[model samples]
Target: MPLRRVAALLLEPMSVFEYAVAAEVFGLDRTDDGVPAFEFITAGPAPGEPVALNTGGAIVPTHRWSDVLDADLVVLPASEILEEYPGELLEVIREAHARGATVLTICSGAFTLAATGLLDGKRATTHWRYLDLLARRYPEVDVTIDVLYVDNGSLITGAGTSAGIDACLHLVRRELGAGVANAIARRMVVPPQRDGGQRQYVRTPVPECTADSLQPVLLHVLDNLHEPHSVTSLAQRAVMSERTFARRFSAETGTTPHRWLLQQRVLRARELLERSDASVEQVAADVGFSSAALLRSHFQTIVGTSPQRYRRAFSTT
Candidate 1:
């Protein structure tokens, strides 16, 4: 279904950046660039009521909570986590989902969605800082860790301010196709595909080397993705032993060197597929995969679709 209508529920003590992420993606006028316009509205618990912002000052929402029920997409931006959200607000969100409106929560907004009982037995992720708490507090919800967002068909949750942008763009890509999603990303000057499985975890207490010390090697790998790289070679590039390098890489990237490189190669293949008329064989070579079959195997595992179908759905050329 086309996502033509959007309503963002404004909770008290709102995080300005997360709310702005929703507004900037959905509320902006982008039809001139061939991106469809969303009938975006911000609403409070009560119609025309003022909701307090954590950054200070109050925003008076012109739409009521009831208006959300009619929206095709309902946004829940990060707000202060509380033991309980207003019953009316929770019920309206519940009804909206029960009637088939797709619900997206940004960062700590997962807390609000959990209160509505929709996350039970479903995988969900919030900001990394609250990962443990979310898992412990909501035992029924299968709280996933180290992901930018979790998508379960009708419900999605994003982590942190930047991840919110990723989730919103991903939804646009899912519902409106890549051309529209890419157009909006171009307007916003952001990368359209930060895969949901990418890590958003914070620094851990595991005694480790300097954070991001492997950044140069990582950047070099990105620049030389077509080249064959191994843990030994990458470790040499970072001036560390293989064991130390592997540990540091995991600490920094939340994935092993092989898996990370595999993901990057597939992502590069996606871009090539979308923008260039490269055959799967050529794209596989371009992204450092040994053969088209290998690329297909890894691509399907990470992207949940084959290259040909992804290209057909998202290719611009």
Candidate 2:
């Protein structure tokens, strides 16, 4: 069924940012921009009770917990981790999923969903800081630490902060269409899709580079993604040794030179597939891939779907 109604479940000590992310994505009326208007509501354990926020404010939800049972989609925003979650709340979550409604969690809200036992034997993610705790506490869950979000069929779990935006937009794109998702993204001033994942944001000590920065070279590579690039050639372009260039590149981009270039090529291919009347082979060559088969392999690996499927779902032309 198409997602026309959305219900956000609020818990005490909520992280305002995550709650706001849900509102920004689904609660706001965007019909003027050619996007469908979602029937959005907020539900809590006690209707009309004020829930304290982690950032020192409180919000009162107008709907009771029962309101979520029939919603097309339910959102769980981050809250302070509690020793025990309410059994009634967990039952509602399980029932919602059993009846074919989608459930999405933002940041630490994964803990609340996990309490329902629905996440057992499924891949999920949380804030990087609490990955170990979630894993240790819920041995049944397969915790993935490096991705911004995990879309395990109907259950979607987003990592910390802005990752919620990515997960929400992905769901909108999946359920509605790329045109609606893109319009919302434009109004919000954010990308409809993002490359790589949370792994790029992991903290690491980078060795300082004495030579000039590779910012210019990086921009040039992005501008000309159709051209073949190698560590040796990029090193020469930056006027540095391959070893120095590799180190600096990793330090600056959080990925190897080859991996970074491959990601960029895939992004370029996506753009061409969505905006141009090019065949798969043409897009492959235009993005520097050796063949359409190779492009399909890399595109599926990075985008989680085949090129043809993606274009069918999202193409503008």
Tens-place lDDT per residue, model 1, 256-280, is 9998898788878888998999899
Off by over 4 Å in 2: 205-317
Instruction: Report the CA-based lDDT of candidate 1 relative to the real structure.
Output: 0.87
Alpha-carbon shift of residue 205 in model 2 (angstroms): 4.6
> What TM-score, computed on C-alpha atoms, does each candidate reach?
0.66, 0.66
Instruction: Give, for candidate 1, the lowest lDDT window spanning 10 residues.
Output: 200-209
Q: In angstroms, how far off is 191's CA in candidate 2?
A: 0.5
On residues 1-317, what C-alpha lDDT tens digit does candidate 2 reach at each position?
A: 67988988988998999999999999899999999989989899888999899989798998887878888999999999889998888888888888888999999999999989999999999998889989988999999876789999799999988999999999999988999999999999998997656644444332233445687787778787778889999999999999999998888777899988888888888788889989999999898998999999988776667788777756999
Against the true structure, candidate 2 reaches a TM-score of: 0.66
RMSD of 2: 9.0
